[model samples]
Target: MPGVVWIALAIVVTIALVLGLGASRLRTLSRRVGSFSCNARASGQDAWTAGIAQYAVGRIEWWRCWSLSPRPARTWYREQLELVGREPFDDDGPGHYLVRCRYEGLDFELDLAAGDYFGLASWLEAAPPGRRDLVL
Candidate 1:
């Protein structure tokens, strides 16, 4: 009985440590420049995931909030994204919109606030000259 109790306590402690590390990593990522709260879903996915997005010179990096790794889970290059659709998303709020886009032949959706949506649009349009034309 005592042995079982000790094992359970150890498991609980390990889980807590992992959670703490993940949260710490998320905080560190959120403090970077151009970071914004964003929700993303892949095409055919039924659920959206919350994460932080940071804009780099020519790409956007998305990092899941509950992950322990520092690397971005997905990277969307500015030149490769094609806007498919944009509509007001009232599920979260009035100013939020669901932006659908295609990258590398795969479609995905991003739920973004008005300000963030505009920022993303501007980023897409500012791609370097001579790249494939992006139909917005």
Candidate 2:
């Protein structure tokens, strides 16, 4: 029916607008660090969810890649974060390595590509002098 068609069109338009706005917001607010993908599990949560991390002025903002939300799901401040450990990814996926980090006494895992790994390492190392202390 004509009403059904109109409703479908409206739904499609709404979805498109949400996606466009989300992408625009992400690009305007943050810069791409590299081809980075991560699955993070909060300290108390047992499940891990996939997301992407963007470098902000003094912190890293992580957003769920599948969601259209404009706000970051988690923000890890540079000064309060420490690298715990790292290991090569076991699966043959795009991610090359897995990094474990502690922020504000909570642990988080980030999976990065080779380039993203270097970029993250550089970002941490380039923090203002005495801002971060390397654990290893």
Root-mean-square deviation of every model: 1.8, 3.5
Model 2, which residues run further than 4 Å from truth? 1-5, 19-36, 43-48, 92-95
* Per-residue alpha-carbon lDDT of candidate 1 for residues 1-136, written as tens digits (9 for 90 to 100): 9999999999999999998898888888889889998899997898999999999878899998877776899999887888889999998979999999999999999999999999888778777787646746
- TM for candidate 1 is 0.89
Per-residue alpha-carbon lDDT of candidate 2 for residues 74-127, written as tens digits (9 for 90 to 100) = 887888878788788755376477778898887877767777777887888889
lDDT of all predictions, in order shown? Answer: 0.88, 0.74
**Candidate 1 residue 128 C-alpha distance from true site, Å:** 1.7
Angstrom error of the Cα, residue 31, model 2: value is 6.5
Global Cα lDDT for candidate 2: 0.74
Q: Where does candidate 1 have its weakest 10-residue lDDT segment?
A: 127-136
TM-scores for all candidates: the values are: 0.89, 0.71
Once superposed on the true structure, which residue ranges of model 1 sit more than 4 Å away at CA?
Answer: none
